[model samples]
Target: MKKIRFYHTLKAKIVIIIAMVIIFALQLMGANFITQTERQLVNNFQENQKLQMNFLENSFAPFLEMHENPKDTSEDIDPEEEINALISDFSGTGITSLIVVDSSFVVIGNSDTTQQVEVGQLLNDEDVRTTILQGSASSKQIINSQLNARRWRMVEPVYSSEDSQAVIGAIVMESNIESIYEQITDITLIFLRASLIAILLSSILANMVSKAITDPIKEMQTKAKAIAEGDYSGEVTIYGNDEIGLLAQNINELSEEVETGQRRIEAERQRLDSVLSNMSEGVIATNRRGELDVANNMASQMLNLSRDELAGQNILSLLEIEEDYSLRDLVDRKEDITLNIEAEEEDALLRASFSVIQADSGYISGIVCVLRDVTEEEKVEEERKEFVSNVSHELRTPLTSMRSYIEALIDGAWKDPELAPRFLDVAQSETDRMIRMIQDLLHLSRIDAGKSELQKELIDLTALFTQVLTRFDMLLDSEEYRFKNYKIERNIINEAIFVDVDSDKIVQVLDNVMNNAIKYSPEGGKITCTMTLENNQVLITVKDEGIGIPAEDLAHIFDRFYRVDRARSRAMGGTGLGLAISREVIEQHDGEIWAESINRDGTTFYIALPYIPYEEEEWGWD
Candidate 1:
């Protein structure tokens, strides 16, 4: 931890705040006490000055009357002498000066002996003149800055006894009332010294008390720092069971709880990692900023990158969807996206589903994406659609032909005897063609459903191939293919190649191949059928000297309803399902079938079945 500045520390702040409050309170109390005491003292001094000025006013009125009317003088005393005696009596009573002014502003007498020469002169004081004019008494406390002393000047107006309304003279008296201020000043100085001593003691006490509170807090702070650094090893020092001490105890308990919770969280994280690594589908998670947060093992493998490469990478760029979707678009998207990932060898199609991660406050925190491989599924769906279309087309062609012929016979063609029989025979042939196509479709459906069971028996491939060629030999002689002029050539082994197989299914496979050979062969072209044992299996091959299948179409030859040339195959009355069904039957017997062809040359299809060698005695042969 760094060193804290004194003013910035809690202890310093507490002491400073307490000192300010104490100073404010003491100043308020001292100021109020001084103001109240000064006001009361001034009031009492003013009352005493008024009483003395009233007595002087009575004593001077008789002398002032004699000066105004000398012809009716009752007593033979001098007016100035009596006024002087009255002024001199108050001189020792804290009076600084006393002056008596008769009517017309003439000074009658003076109490200060040094100012006795101004007895008959007019008084030069403006306050004395203003007091006589206004016929009112006034007092003013004046400070003589030159003399460095304070005094109170009081003025009184005297009226004659003979006529109460008549102004006789005015008395002005100055009293040294500086003692009032001296007393206040002395008390103020004492209070200031006491306040300083008190403030000094208070600061010391504040520092000590603040330390008691802050010491525990500092210890708790150190403990908190240790906890933050993953070292929850110690407890905060407790001073007492006060709020601060209770806080220390809570911090200790919290450290223990955090340690336990951290362990549980670590265990949960490990389990999640294991599950994610073993998952078949790829999983990716991103933060609110769309940066990658978690990329599981499968996700890394699927993307052909490592976890390190994915970390902190934007999710849009990582998934290669930056061009299509922004982060906000993915967050708001309602449907799954199909992504075609380009690779060096081949492209893969992955279906990505998105789920938003939301907090309890309804904030969208991130997104989780699950990727599933959907390549094979999409391919199968396309094939199924093509299969349905082909089946419909094949069935519709024969049905339409039969409907036309039958309608023609019913529309009086039967009455023409010649056209009627031909129409009926054509309809019957179309019906048979439709029936045959339907049967092939049902057989294929059974094979796809895994319901085609093979009835296995030991059979000789040599005899089976010879017998098949013999059937074709008789077929060429029949009227249907007699004009075709085809020949069947047999290249078979003399020794018997014995194998366990379903004889009926094998015969059907053979018939399908031989029919294709005869149908596609050129006129007088020879159909070479060969049978041999190779690689622990029996291989049967049929080669046709017809228009060779295109190299691109060879791979799909065994696919249902697939034709190299649909028009020619349809014109020849071929269902396009014979080779497909043949392939299925051969595959069910644990055999393989494929074709090799070149354009403008010839196509050869080979069927390889598992073969077994047996002794003649086992077969009951001579």
Candidate 2:
């Protein structure tokens, strides 16, 4: 720390200050007294010099007033000797020197005989020159610092006796102040003695005041140190209720307030922790610098990291966002923005939003992020869009065809009976296809909406299988049929295999499968229909000895509007919704329908129905 000198301490400082202030005061008082004394002495000296100069100027008045004629002889005007004699009279009166100068600053007379003298010489002194130029009496003291002697100069202007306004010359004189210096020396010794006595007296008072001030201050410091160390117990004794006393009271109150605030803050922290831990949405907070500050369990889970792992980590690194994008950019937005991020080790998509935590100054102090798992939501939205698009496409083809056919009939195709009948028939067929597609769409929609009710009833699987076979035989044996003599074989493992099912919907499902088999079967090929019991459920298979479905199309055979051979199925008067409808119907009965394909040999479709005893199954179609 700080290196404090002894003088900087309170006692030393107080003593020094008192000493300085007292010394300055005494010195000023003494200086003023000495200055007044010296001024009076100088005034007296100048007055005496003025009296002398007046006497000499009066003596030379006649010589100056009687302007000599240019033709006057030496006997008539010999005033130079009288001027020199007048200057000699003041030689022993402590007068250092006296010179009479004309208006030109040229010395005309000198008083001191022992010194060098010239009747006509320039003084080479500004004081004398100023006196001569300004024609005014001026006095100054020339103090010799080493010798402790002061020399005084008095410059007096002499006017002509005849015309007082006309200046004749000036007199410059010097005097010594050795006697005054001796008196001043004696006064200085007395003043020094008084100053020392005063200083000794002040030292005691300074010590007392310094201790009075510093004692309370040191106590306050000790109590403050305790408070700084988290100790709130202290007694601050008031000292005269001064500013320092008031400061002590404030410090005590501050300590009490700090202790109370710490407890309140702890309670608030616990409440916040409880709220954050149980929230469903992942909550994360970051400081203004975009480094992580607080995170909840859900936030850690969403980031696929532990709470410890996220500590001090930059939030930007959690998301593989676009180039030059950062968490600060998102947090600085006017409103919350959705940021797509990978969560769960980059396996799931999380839609994270950043909300700004602003201070009272309206500056962003931190960022609070809310994250939602939207992977499934995004998939569903895409599926909905695709469904709408597919439905529109499917409806448009038939609509376009119907429009064309109807226009053809209206635009004179009806005038020719053959073309008119052909166009009308095609239009009717297109309308029928549209109706079937709409019905299938409605059925599937009802199932998806969980509104489709199954009238499940008890039925014999063998009887149901035989009934389905009979319907197919009748369809093939009709008069307008194209296939000739299609061989069909039935293999029933048990005479009566009971199953709980929606009998009518199961009939529809089996019919669709058998029809599909017949459509792809080779001409006169054998179709083997078998029924067996496996795992307490009836398993039925429809194997077609025709061109089997390709391996690639097997999985998608049950998909809506999917066909192995699209062109061929369309030609066979198929709406391409049969297998899709069949799958839905089978599932409604708590059964499953799937296709097994062999590249070119044949394909078998299996149906598994849950077996329910006649006593337990619901007999009514309810």
CA lDDT scores, all candidates in order: 0.86, 0.77
Top candidate by TM-score: 1
Query: Estimated TM-score per prediction?
Result: 0.44, 0.43
Query: Which candidate gets the maximum lDDT versus the true structure?
Result: 1
Regions of candidate 2 where Cα sits further than 4 Å from its true position: 1-280, 283-380, 613-622
Worst 10 residues of 1 by lDDT: 111-120
lDDT of 2 by residue, 538-585 (tens): 889999988888888888988887778876876676777778888888
lDDT of 1 by residue, 73-124 (tens): 7676877777788777778987888888887998888887666348788777
What is the C-alpha local distance difference test score of candidate 2? Answer: 0.77
Cα lDDT for residue 481, candidate 2 = 56
The residue-level lDDT of candidate 2 at 87 comes to 72
